[model samples]
Target chain A: MSSGDHTAHVHRDDYGSRMGMWLFLFTELILFGGLFLIYAVYRFMYPTEFHVAAMELDTVFGAVNTIILLTSSLTIAMSITALQRNRKTLSLVLQFATILLAISFMVNKYFEWGAKFGYGLYPGSEMLLDKPSGEILFFGLYYTMTGLHGLHVLIGIVFIGIIMYQVWIGRVHSTNYVRLESAGLYWHLVDIIWIFLFPLFYLII
Target chain B: MANGTLYMPETEPNYLDYRGRFKGILGWILSTDHKRIGLLYLYSMGLFLTVGIFFGFMMRLELIAPGKVIIEPQTYNSFFTLHGIIMIFLFIIPGLPAVFGNFFLPILIGAKDVAFPRINLLSWWLFAIGGGLAITSVFLPGGPADTGWTFYVPYSIRSTTNVLPAAFAAFILGFSSILTGINFVTTIHRLRAPGMDWFKMPLFIWSLYATAWIQVLATPIIGITLLLVAVERLFGIGLFDPALGGDPVLFQHLFWIYSHPAVYIMILPAMGVISEIIPVFARRTIFGYSFIAFSSLAIAFFGSLVWAHHMFTAGMSDTGRFVFSLLTFLVAIPSAIKVFNWIATLYKGSIQLAPPMLYALGFIFLFSIGGLTGLMQGALSINIHIHDTSFIVGHFHYVMFGGTGFGIFAALHYWLPKMYGRMYNEKRAKVGFWVLITGFNLLYFPMLVMGWLGMPRRYYDYLPEFHVYHFISTIGSWILITGLLIMAVNLILGVRRGAKATDNPWGGETLEWRIQTPPTHENFHEIPVITGGPYEYKINENGQEEKKYEEVT
Candidate 1:
């Protein structure tokens, strides 16, 4: 919807929007929560292999992506604050910056996955099949969890991109910025999940 | 009525009418009105029920005389698989919450509509798309999924059938469920009328609240599990594939983690419907109001912990088995609390033997049998004997079909008039109830016995020793289907041609009764300030409290 396309009816409230967003974030956490559960179970089953496989993950790339995600999380939170204070240009710029960081994180993820594929560590690969089952599981979880995390980064970018436009058009301004805040919370959630992911996959070694 | 008094006899633009901005079907299909959305769910559920039951009928027909009477084993496998998928995902899981919860939750809690109406509409659209995808899978080259609705790994991974579409369809349906949950929870928390406290809210809303939490929290696990299954099938992702270092049994762990809470999802709301009906007919305040209310939350909480009971025979540890078994039996307490309260509410009270009340009583009876048999199955030693047998199947049907199915019927009879503004033939409704119950018991009870005697489920062919139970069960299916048909015809005719009903026909104390019989498009003319609890049945003729003094004593 356009900036001026705000409907006249239906009373809107910030608290309800925030509560709805919080509840939704719970679902998203639990969405990744399931993956983490699987990860925990497998790690418990195969710690040595998981640790060995963790050494194979490119730490520099993961560390860089983690920095990008955390920074992006900061920018989005600042963006919401800026919007709340009616700093329109600043809010839009911060949001755009957040989007760029999300893209950078994904770019790093792509290279990491490509490097793994180059090494023939992809799921169901002959090389992977020859590895110990624990190593197979560690790499499997790495690719799947990070791949799913990458998907979230992609979704979060699109989400922020929309709000960036909304903020520009004044549809998501000081008076009506819950949309922006909600998107920010989602971005932070994506970042938080990556924070856990980065340590699990890259630092666990 | 809002206060057990005011109602609109004069006509207005009811939600059922094509009086909205969009003309005709678009008015409903495109509408964001909770009532319209509820109807959309109701209509779609009816369609799926028919499709599910027809498959069920075919399965029964094939099982009538034992060895592949009318269909091959493969066909039978696909039939039961498709039936379970459609019935569980499309019908039962979404049955009460999507339909009745949508229609009445807003009204009962004295809100104009749910917290997020647009999201509510979106939920239905997703439901439609998910349903379409499922139906489309049936005609695909490999035919419908034969891996069963559970989509247990290894077989699910190895099956040549269209697993991805079916699994993804369920995944998509789970989103609709999660969204509905979000809306209901937000609405309950944020949208209640000024004076309507949580306890003052009707038991249906309480049940919906409990159901919504499970839907929101538990559904995502299944969503991720299903997606992982799809991903595994699509790309040989070693997540659940044992050949790829993935454990297959872990799949069961994740599946039932959601699926078991899903049973509470199916039954809790049904129990809530019975709770609403019992006190209304009995003309007394609900016995143990907060007890019934908290017990709903209790069931939802305890229900999630008992998922491993499903895996006891799947090679669990003795400690794991012992723990899950204890939790499973413990979870039965809330349900028992509800049952006792319902009976106590009915005792010595001025009970109206209405069709709704009959179905309510029937629900208790059938659901009790279902619950008791479930206890039998839950016992660690006993479950090993009947793990994959017809006894488990019988217990499942009694709870789901007999309990939730009859629960839906009771709800339909009780509120259809408020929905359509017309009354059905009570005598005919009762006849449908009777035949359905009789056919139900005859159909399922024997399976329980046969299960104990070692009749394995999901088999197209049975040994001649099991032939007698199969025959009787098939006959029961016939009677059940006939009863269902009669009930369907009766309700359909009532909606079309029956006499118009007055608002507050039941003289119940819910807010929906305060408005038009068929509520207006906006639902409330003015948002009602709740004055009292939902089931305060007033005294009649002699100004007595309508106490069945002796019965309570």
Candidate 2:
């Protein structure tokens, strides 16, 4: 990352960087997209079982996590706007807020999953095994999708944390903040995938 | 290293010998030079390819006369699985794009380097790790996965072999592929030299652009699918478990969803290489430039829709089978357009059958056979017959080996001299080509024949009736290896001590030809301003010489 290291600094295009980030986000979407396809097929095959399985997932936890993620997305977006306006303090604070929200989302997820484990209702559990196969598949997808989403949240927190350090170091300021913007784009994608997952898993009838 | 007086005075050192803060091997592994990274891929891929070829050779030796030629049946199962994994993921999947694409994409488009140089290096590292994990699986507690490269479920889940590591290897390799795809797509879009419009870029760039999109979009599907498989195996996730009322057929759907389009990821860039070689060696502009370029996009787009053809015998709805079968047939049109255009480019032109052109022409011949047979298997009835036969094996090797393998050789021969500032021995390179081609056809064609005559693939033993075809195919493997050795030696010798090569050895009209023989770390002294199409060769209509377009200044 030294200026003398290589040609990465010679001709940097923020637009190109953003485009690369978007393309990467597309790959992320499709990765979860494959999981969603499986979810839909199974839900269709076992509707009543899926309905019964849906009841097991506490909507309060799902709704609380959804709102937390949505607010974090807004904070991250505002953090970029603040950076663009050269309000470094505001940007850092908003970034911290976003990171805090993401952590809360994870905390909510841990408890929700913990509750299920207490009930012995997880994948391959004896209780879940005694239930219908459709219910087994529903919880399987619920764990997989939310677990993957939670991992992304952790990664996003780390990503934003690093960007926060960069911002504090004055490396990313008003004039050069594509790194910040790219991270924001990734965080939003994480949020958007949750938007889809929440209604599909928690709100399913 | 100068070959002629027309060359300009050298300023910076060529990429090969250039040293940075990190010296020697560290310089290469840590350096972000696209050319150096390309060479890294080449050397690493070359190593893995040799390992893969050894596995293949042993398999062919095993199948030489049917019963117990070398390894036990379990060992044979592991060998074929490892062979498919190593060859497809390690060698061919990332084959042309990773090696040649990284080396030349920036240069071809008149740029200094790829869009994300660090990510480019990261991709190479990930590739090495993935390949390492795959090879290491064989030595792991259980032998390598016997579930084939497809890693079909139920068996993949039940088999106690080292499926986890193999699956993880494939998943990690998928990340490498996606990163390269992102780098290339962004580089092509944002880094094209000024005045180089989309239509004005080289056909190879066009093909890379299309291939990059597929790589980005399709590879992730495989990533998640494999992860699901691994999860099913470890945690009993039951997503693909039939015992849990999960549909195993869904795994096939998800796997092929990425994998079938992955065929395009392998071949489209090969087609791009052929497009570049054909016009350059023929000493004429490419025929139907837009058609050939558009055909690449067409192939990438339609190639995605036909994954289900692989599942025809997996009991798809009749309507689903019909749709996929039709899409498979439709996909053939764009490929045919390319083959026809290449042939027409050769027609009535003063064609130079150099080592590269020889391989390119051979690609055209072999890919056509591979492709047409593919259409045969696309038919629902025919697919039922040849679904798991040696014919399926023959069909892929012909296309994958004959098509992409030759394309890689052609690119190496065509570009390596420029990369190394030395020419390979023409006679030896040609001799290598002839031996390789003859051995290639002899090795694979019989598999196609025996497959038609009911020879099942992946079998350690076969019926006596299929013995002759297997025997002939096994001998073909020997010839093929000899030819490969000849080519490898000749190319290596050429790189080390061959005659100094001129800047534009084959009279190529692309931007790569305009750079130094062995390009400096920064490809162009200053990026050129392009003003015309990539293949704008001079024409001699009615014996009156005429230039095609305003030259890049």
True contacts kept of 1: 0.61
Q: What's each prediction's TM-score?
A: 0.97, 0.97
**For model 1, what is the alpha-carbon lDDT of residue B291?**
98
lDDT tens digits, residues B1-553, model 2?
Answer: 1112222557777888776778889888887888989999999999999999998999999988867877899988998999999999999989999999999999888888899999999999999999999999899898788999999988899999999999999999999999999999999989988888898888888899999999999999999999999998889876879888899899999999999999999999999999999988777888999999999999999999999988888888999999999999999999999999999999878777888999999999999999999989988889899888999999999999999999999999999988888888889999999999899989999999988888888899999998898888999999999999999999999889787887777877788877777888777776688877888776333443322122223
Pairs in clash, predicted candidate 1: B1-B514, B348-B548
* Model 2 residue B87 lDDT score: 94
Clashing residue pairs for model 2: none
Candidate closest to the true structure, highest DockQ: 2
Residue range B1-553, candidate 1, lDDT tens digits? 2554333445456777636557778777778888889989999999989999999999999999966588888888899999999999999999999999999998888877888888899999999999999999999999889998999999999999988899999999999999999999999999898888887999999999999999999999999999988888777777878887788888899999999999999999999999999988888889999999999999999999999998988998899999999999999899999999999998877888989999999999999999999999889999999999999999999999989999999999999988988888878999998999999988999999999999999988889999899989999999999999999999999889887777767757688878876887667766777777787765454645322111111
Candidate 1 docking class: medium
